[model samples]
Target: MTEETHLNPTQPVNQQIYRILRRDIVHCLIPPGTPLSEKEVSLRFDVSRQPVREAFIKLAENGLIQIRPQRGSYVNKISLNQVRSGGFVREAIERAVVRRAAILVTDAQLYQLEQNLNQQRTAIDRHQLNDFFQLDDDFHQILCDIAQCRLAWETIENIKAAMDRVRFMSLDHVTPHEMLLEQHWAIFRALEKHDEQLADETMHQHLAEISASVLLIRQENRDWFTEEQ
Candidate 1:
């Protein structure tokens, strides 16, 4: 694996390493089951073993790596169960969030949502996949913020790691940016009308799209998934 040389120097070395490694793992640049050595990583990043080890610990805590005392650390295979559980929690929480947002969203927030959608369109047209992904996240987060349930997004963040890995994997192939944009537009329209039921239903259908992609991804990348999948 190539070292990330552009990490912010002002941050703690461990945090910088952790973020780089986490991004690599989630994006499948560092494939599942690949061994990660503290010594090698330290050398690669021109950092010391201490920070590398600390980064490994954080990655393990996030379920992105498995650390075996004697065998060393390796990237964790994607857990289907974890993805399903996270999806369930996200769907439940986000459905409620959108329902509330539909009722409570202000004109200012609605304009912000429109701007986000416009940026999303630009990302799609330019084929900037990563930008699209970040904008997609921002779109949902705005809904949570408008709902006065910003903390609920923090909850989703914790459980959605596996789902995010799946999303990154699916981005280049299965899931089209336009499709996701359409779903977001649908949810926005429902919210525009302040129709809670329609917003709830739209959110449900939006999330279900991931479930469909998961099956295809699991089949194609069998080695990247745990046996439970």
Candidate 2:
């Protein structure tokens, strides 16, 4: 595993470590089934073992790692069931959110969506994959907010961790970011026109791509997935 580049002294050490490890795991930098050592991670980050242990606990809670009593902690392989379950929840909530957003969105909120799309284009042009991914998330989040369903967005966040890992793996391999951007545009248009049916259909199509990508990725990286999947 690569050492974290820098740590902010002001922030909580465990949270920082958790975020770094989470990003690496999600991006497949630390491949599935690789053992993690508290000692090594602590030394690498120049922090104490306590923070590393705390970080591991958080990672395990997020389904990114498996902690064995005596064996060791290892990055958990992707579960196909979790991916499907997450996708189902995401689609159900987002479809409804978009439908309501189509009816409730205002001109200012529409402009915000436009600005987000412009930033996404800039991120793509600059080859900033991470930035593009964040923007993509923000786009859907904004729609949820516009629909006055902040609670729904919170639920989606909790359930989408598995789908997020799949998305990270899909980037630059199974799907192009531009294609995702286009889908966002379609959804944006639907909201602009206040077409609930169109919004619902577009949201469904957009999220369905994740399932297709998961199938392709599983074939390519079999070891990264669980046997039970």
Candidate 3:
């Protein structure tokens, strides 16, 4: 993965830091539960400890990291709560989004989605995990564009960040990968017919399994997930 480029000054420093770090963490470029030292980050970024500290504080606010009083910062363990909440929110938005996309989606857009799906197939065949994951992200974002609610796509993105690590971890599972491709086909068909209800239902069904998917990860990497229920 490329280094996260921090955005310019319209936003707060901590916010920029949080966003950059969040992306890296979600992508598993930085391993989960890995310790993060503010001093180290400060030196790396050529910033003060305060900004780095502030950044960690913001990540803490987002539950993306944990800080101990004397000990250094560390990536937080995988959160079942983030998975549950993100899945819930995605279901609600995608229900509306897929339905709307069905009505508004043009043939061109549908073709584009098909092309995107084709790349996903290629990624699978080539065993290119990064490319597959990137295509998967593009597919969903493009669907949200079809719905014409760009901000809804942004909301979907923020929610995705929380569940992404779990996704990255389990994405190697062949059955789910094949199942996801099939689900995309179903969604594409429902959208093509402008069948809002069918599209909505299909999208919900797609997101609703996220919790179960994470549970599979929980079983394999008990250390990565939360200890609580």
Query: Taking the tens digit of each residue's C-alpha lDDT, what string does model 1 give over 1-229?
Result: 5456665778899988987888788878889889999998888888879999999998887788999999999999999998988899999999999999999998899999999999999999999987998898899999999999889998887678789899988987798898999999999999999999999999999999889999899999998898553
Candidate 3 positional error at 151, Å:
1.7
- Clashing residue pairs for model 3: none
Cα-based TM-score, every candidate: 0.89, 0.90, 0.82
Q: Write the per-residue lDDT of candidate 3 for residues 160-199, one digit (tens) a residue.
A: 6667888788777823677888888899999889998899
Q: What value does the lDDT take at residue 194 in candidate 1?
A: 94
Question: Backbone clashes in each candidate structure, one number apiece?
Answer: 0, 0, 0
Runs off by more than 4 Å, candidate 2? 1-5, 8-12, 227-229
Pairs clashing in candidate 1?
A: none
For the record, the alpha-carbon RMSD of candidate 2 to the native fold, in angstroms, is: 2.1
Query: What tens digits encode model 2's per-residue C-alpha lDDT throughout 1-229?
Result: 5565589999999999988998888877898889999998988899889999999998887688899989889999988888998899889899989999999999999999999999999999999998998899899899989999899987887677677888988988688998999999999999999999999999999999998999998999888887443
The alpha-carbon deviation from the true structure for residue 41 of candidate 3, after best TM-score superposition, in angstroms, is 2.7
Model 2, residue pairs in steric clash: none
